[model samples]
Each structure stands twice: as C-alpha cells, then as structure tokens.
Target: MEEKKIVSIEDRIPKLKEARKKKANRRLLFYLSIFFLLIAAIIYLQSPLSNIKHIEVTGNKIISDEEIIQLSGLSPETNIWVINHKQLKQSIEKNPLIKEIKVKRKLPQSVQIQISEHKIVGYVKSELEYHPVLESGMIINKHNISNKGDGPLLINFDDEEYLKRMAKELGEIPDHIFNLISEISWEPTEKNKYKVVLYMNDGFIVHATLRNFASKMKTYPSIIAQLDEGEKGIVHMGVGTYFEKLEK
Candidate 1:
C-alpha cells in the first residue's frame, strides 16, 4: 500500500495567502476599471462630442425649416443630455400654425423635429394680397397672392368671430365638396346673422349659413348631381334645400 501524503497547515499557509492576495487584487482592479469607465462616460457626455451636430425638421408646410428650427431654440452648441424636450415642444408650438410638435434625439449627435400644422382651409383677400386662413382659425400673413391650392376665396370677412366660425365649419366639410367652393362672401341678414354666399367652381352659387354650413354643404354634391347639367343656377340651403336656374 502507498503511504498517504498530507500537506501540513504551516506549508499550506503561504499558498492560501497567495490565493487571497490574488483575489483582492482582482477585486481592486475591477473596481478601478468601473470607476474609470464611469468618469470617462461623464466626460464624454459633457464634452462637445455629445453636442447636437445635426438637426432635421419635417412635416412643415407653411413654416420653413429654418423658422421651425429657430422656434425650437436648439442649436449645434446644445448638449443632448441637457435638452428639455417638453420645453422645446412648447417653444415650437408657439407658432399658431403648428398644431403639434415632436422632438427626439439620436445616438452620437443628431436631433429631429416633427411638426403637424393646421390645414389651410381658405384665403382671405386683404387688399391686393391674399392671406392664408388655417383650419385652426389662424390667418398667416406671410403668403400673399400665392394660392396654395383651390380653396374658397374669402371676401369681406372682417369679423374675427365670424371668420373663426367659418373656418371651423369649413374644416368639417369633406374635401370633395370643399374644393368645389371657389369663393365665399359674408352676406348677413337680420334673420340669420351667419348667412354667407358661396360661389362654387362648378358655376353654381350656394347660399348657406355658417351655423349649419358643414351639414348643409355635405348635401351639395347630391343636389347638384340632380340638376340639369347645362343649367347654371343658385342653390339655396340656408333655410331649406332648393335650386333656381339663372335667367338666360
């Protein structure tokens, strides 16, 4: 039988101490590495490396990209970490045309601004120029004499309340019928203060009131379709639905 060899406690002490020393060194090294990595990350975030290098603005029609960016109050020098997205959105929404705005950050150094603007419903004639009226009841003065699309040309609409009401009514109108309206005039009557005359692109004149304009105007296509194709006339829907052919 082979004799069993047992290591004495005194002999094993040096090896045990060496193992403990290695373990302690590994722990210290791991902590030091973690501390250095944290410091590096902090420095990187504060440095120009984290600055906004690119800015993109989209979904704007009336407001220019430059103007939207200016309104956002963000610049190339802005730090991504310190940017307040809520404040940015509020600042950009200050423009009445902007219905909603979104701000987002991309890794490295890029920012994006997405905007939703009120739809342009019509244009109010101001002297020789025409100002755009938005669905939100805001009139943009920047564009003059430049027609964006075929929308109703508002005439003699001086009352702000009436204009806003008209805008609200116009917004609810379907695109197919809304596009047919060529012009609108605020022709009020004692019976109905909200009465207005609409000149349609199809050569039919519409007499409607802003109070029930949207609901009444929705029936315009069907009413016009029933009329004689060659007969040019005035369709009355303000009080009731009827049509009268123009005298030849």
Candidate 2:
C-alpha cells in the first residue's frame, strides 16, 4: 500500500477563495460595528429622551406652568442644545411682578427653573378689585386683595409711583407704631407735589407730606415715642414738620 499526496491548481484555488471570503466577511462585520457605535453615541447626545429628560419649576404663585412656558418659549419638544436660556430669562422678567429667576440643566436631559415672585408690601384699591403692591414700586390690579388693615391706605388718588414709595415706608416703621390707627390720603395739594395726610387708626391725626419721605419717616419713631396712646390730636408734618397737639 502506497500513501499518495494529491495537488491540483483547481483544488488550491477553491481553498484560497474560501479563505479570502472569510477575511472579507470579518472586515465587513468590523466596519458595521464601528458605524453602529458612532450612530448610537450621536443619538444619545441629541435624543430628547436622553437630553433634558425632566423639567421642574419653583417659586411660582399666580404665574402658572403654562404661563411660564409660554413666556419662556419652552415646550416639551424644546431642543436643549440650541435653547438660549439667557433670552428666556429676559422674557420672563418682563413681567413687573417677577423679581428674580434662575435656570439649571442636569445630565441625561433634565432642566429646572426656579423663580422668585414679587411680594405685596401693601395694596392699591382699584374700581372693583385691588392689586397687590410690589416692593419695587409696581402695581397690578389683578391679584387677590388682602386686607392689610392699617399701615397706610392710599385713597382718592391714582399715583402709582407714590404708592410704591409709601409702601416701602411701612416696612421701616415698627409694627407697633404702624398699629397706631391710621388711614393715608393722597391729596394733590398743589401741582406735582403730592402731599400725604395720615389719619391715626385711633383718633389722632398725622399730617405727612411727601418730602424727604424716608428722613421724615425716621422721625416718627422718636416723635411718637413722646405721645401718649390717648393723645388724640393731629400731628402735622406738612409745613416745617411739626405736630399740632390738641388738648384732650
């Protein structure tokens, strides 16, 4: 029995073709894997599901989410990449009532908006409804009226700027001094010079004119310091700032 070795170009050619086919298949698989990975990374970065996936809001009272979204130009489909957050802030702050605002972005697609709303230091009485007076000297006739029962109520005048200035004074006077019975009247005594007449919530009267207002307000604590609770008389600050004490 003789062992025979077989050799033929036809047989070798088929083997060579099979090897080449296997190498080509492996390279194609490698290229496909790289392409799919690149696509996955891009989608992860740009997809709404992965970017800005959550939204939160805070510091909003009368302003609703819908109102904020409308004013901010933010929506469920807003693209986080191109959203100009600074511009959104400017638009939201356009409302006189909004004092401050802050926005933050989180990883994996989340956004949060924090807000600071204006406070009602006092109120302005309108025809049917009264609006909350902001500390910054703005009046809105739409907010629910709260009875701030006795610091100073401006009546018979429509001076928005003066009302805001007066509201700030309420914060200066101690609560105890404020409780001293009073109604504030905005009477246009002469021209642009608006004078304020104070009615003691009690029976005494305080004549307050709008001049160096904050300075005059500082005198109230010391001035009232001497007056008795029952000394019901008119304390005047209109001319040269003096109190006309009436005998009990």
Choose the strongest candidate by lDDT. Answer: 1
Write out the backbone clash pairs for model 1.
none
> 35-134 in candidate 2: lDDT tens per residue?
9999997886577765455677787775776677668877767766666888989998877767899988765566778888765455556667655556
Tens-digit lDDT track of model 1 for 1-248 = 99999999999999999999999999999999999999999999889999999998888766788888888898988998899988998888877778988888887899989898788889988779877898877888864222265578888788989999999999999998888888999988787889899898888898888987899899988998898779889899967789988998
Number of clashes in every candidate structure? 0, 9
* Candidate 2, RMSD to the unseen true structure: 9.5
Give the C-alpha lDDT of model 2: 0.68
TM-scores of the models, in the given order?
Answer: 0.84, 0.59
Cα-based lDDT at residue 233, candidate 1: 90
* Cα shift from native, residue 108, model 2 (Å): 4.3
Per-model lDDT: 0.86, 0.68
**Which ranges in model 2 have alpha carbons more than 4 Å from their true place?**
1-41, 51-54, 58-66, 116-121, 133-138, 142-152, 159-183, 190-192, 199-204, 229-231, 238-248
